[model samples]
Target: MMTDALTLLRTRKSPKVFDLAAPGPSPTELDQILAIASRVPDHGKLAPWRFIVFEGDGRARAGEIIAGVFVNDNPEADADRVAIERNRLMHAPLVVAVVSRADAHAKVPEWEQTLSGGAAATLVVLAAHALGYAATWLTQWYSYDPRVRAGLGLGEGERIIGFVHVGTLARPQEDRPRPPLADIVTRF
Candidate 1:
């Protein structure tokens, strides 16, 4: 595993459909995953991110919070759709919310700080995959809703980078389409 850096980089994929019944990273394992996540490049060493983990009952609590706000936002949404909101965090055994605490600072630009937070979120997905777990990073409408942000204790300047859902896969995810480097990249 240590020697397969290129292979792992080329093959890592995020899986959204996870095995809810399967156990997620143990406490120790999760700690390690977070440790790896914290290793992202940070301009000015601002460390502009923090993690909020939702596991077990925490997932349900978060779901309820988001679901209530969802119901309020989409009053026309039927019971089924509302119910889907309640299960958002339950799709995985563990969900981690990467919070971006980017703010105006002397040395580091807010954009760079925000990018560091995003890098931390990506690192989380990669760390989970390396630990034999599947993960997906998602931020839907609820992510930007002020009510949901209030429920997450987000401050005025703080924002959610994304939610990384981690667990075992219910079924193998086939590789999907990839963009051609020739089309997306150009030499300076």
Candidate 2:
């Protein structure tokens, strides 16, 4: 069991967002994924993160919001560029936007809460991989755009940690090179 877990962890890889195809996690699986993703460390018991799921027509709506923001920001952008922004979420069958709602807390620092949000997003990827799906966590320009944020109904205190794109891989992805432990690790 230990070896199996290790192997799953070692073999997990993030494919390019465009390489992710259709047939994402079913409704039940999505519920399981979100539940697993939420099981992260939270100091002060403050769950400072929430998820925004985009599927089917929702993805297109999000894309329109993104494209609108992009066009407003860059008037020189051509149709193709606008279309690319418009279809940003169409590549993946499902997208889960992890919003960090870190706020002022007497006992818990905002930084800790933010880290917990990041952990939640990371777990989303891991959970998808464990369930035989490909996922890539991304945060493009739209994530930080004020107009896009407003269109997406993000509150002033809330910020997007990432957009976890989950789907089936069109083809296998090769593992990228990792830094050697000797080069990075050190004894205290």
Candidate 3:
């Protein structure tokens, strides 16, 4: 069992793109995934992360809002560039926006809360992979843009931790070589 778990962990990779797959997890399945993702090591019961699911027309609406913000923010922005930014959300059938919301009164530091949010996003990606879907966690320029945040209705203290895209694999992704373990670890 341990070996099987380790093998699964080792084989997981972030897919860059996905194919059109109907019957992606239903609402119940997504709830299960989010429930598992919520098991990250959070210092307090202050669930610092929230997931925003965007599908179908919602994706297009989000894209339009983002594009509008881009144009409003930069009057000189290229039209094609703006269009590309708007279309980003249309790439996947499902997109989960993971938001980090720090607690002001908690004993845990804000940094820890941020870490917890990141961990939750990672778990969501893994859960998608376990469900036989390709998943990628990304935070592009839009994630940090104030206009985008406003459009998403994120509070002042909240920030996007990641945008997880999930669907069937469009094509097999080639494995990139990894750094040696010795180079990354040092046992005292």
State which candidate has the highest lDDT: 2
Q: Write the per-residue lDDT of candidate 2 for residues 1-188, one digit (tens) a residue.
A: 99988988998888999899989999999999999988999998889999999999999999999998888889999999899999999999999999999999999999999999999999999999999999999998889887788899899879999999999999978889999999999999
The lDDT of each candidate is 0.88, 0.94, 0.85
Q: Give the winner by TM-score: 1 or 3.
A: 1
Candidate 3 has a TM-score of: 0.92
Evaluate model 2: give its TM-score: 0.98
Error (Å) of candidate 1 at residue 44 is 1.5
The lDDT of model 3 is 0.85
Show where candidate 3 strays beyond 4 Å. 18-23
Question: Model 3 — which ten-residue stretch has the worst lDDT?
Answer: 17-26
Candidate 3 C-alpha lDDT tens digits along 53-161: 9888988999998888878878898888888878877888888999999877549898898999999999998888878877888898899997788888898878999
Report the Cα lDDT for residue 147, model 1.
84
Specify the poorest-scoring 10-residue window by lDDT in model 1.
Answer: 14-23
**Candidate 2 residue-wise lDDT at 23:** 96
Q: Which pairs clash in the backbone of model 2?
A: none
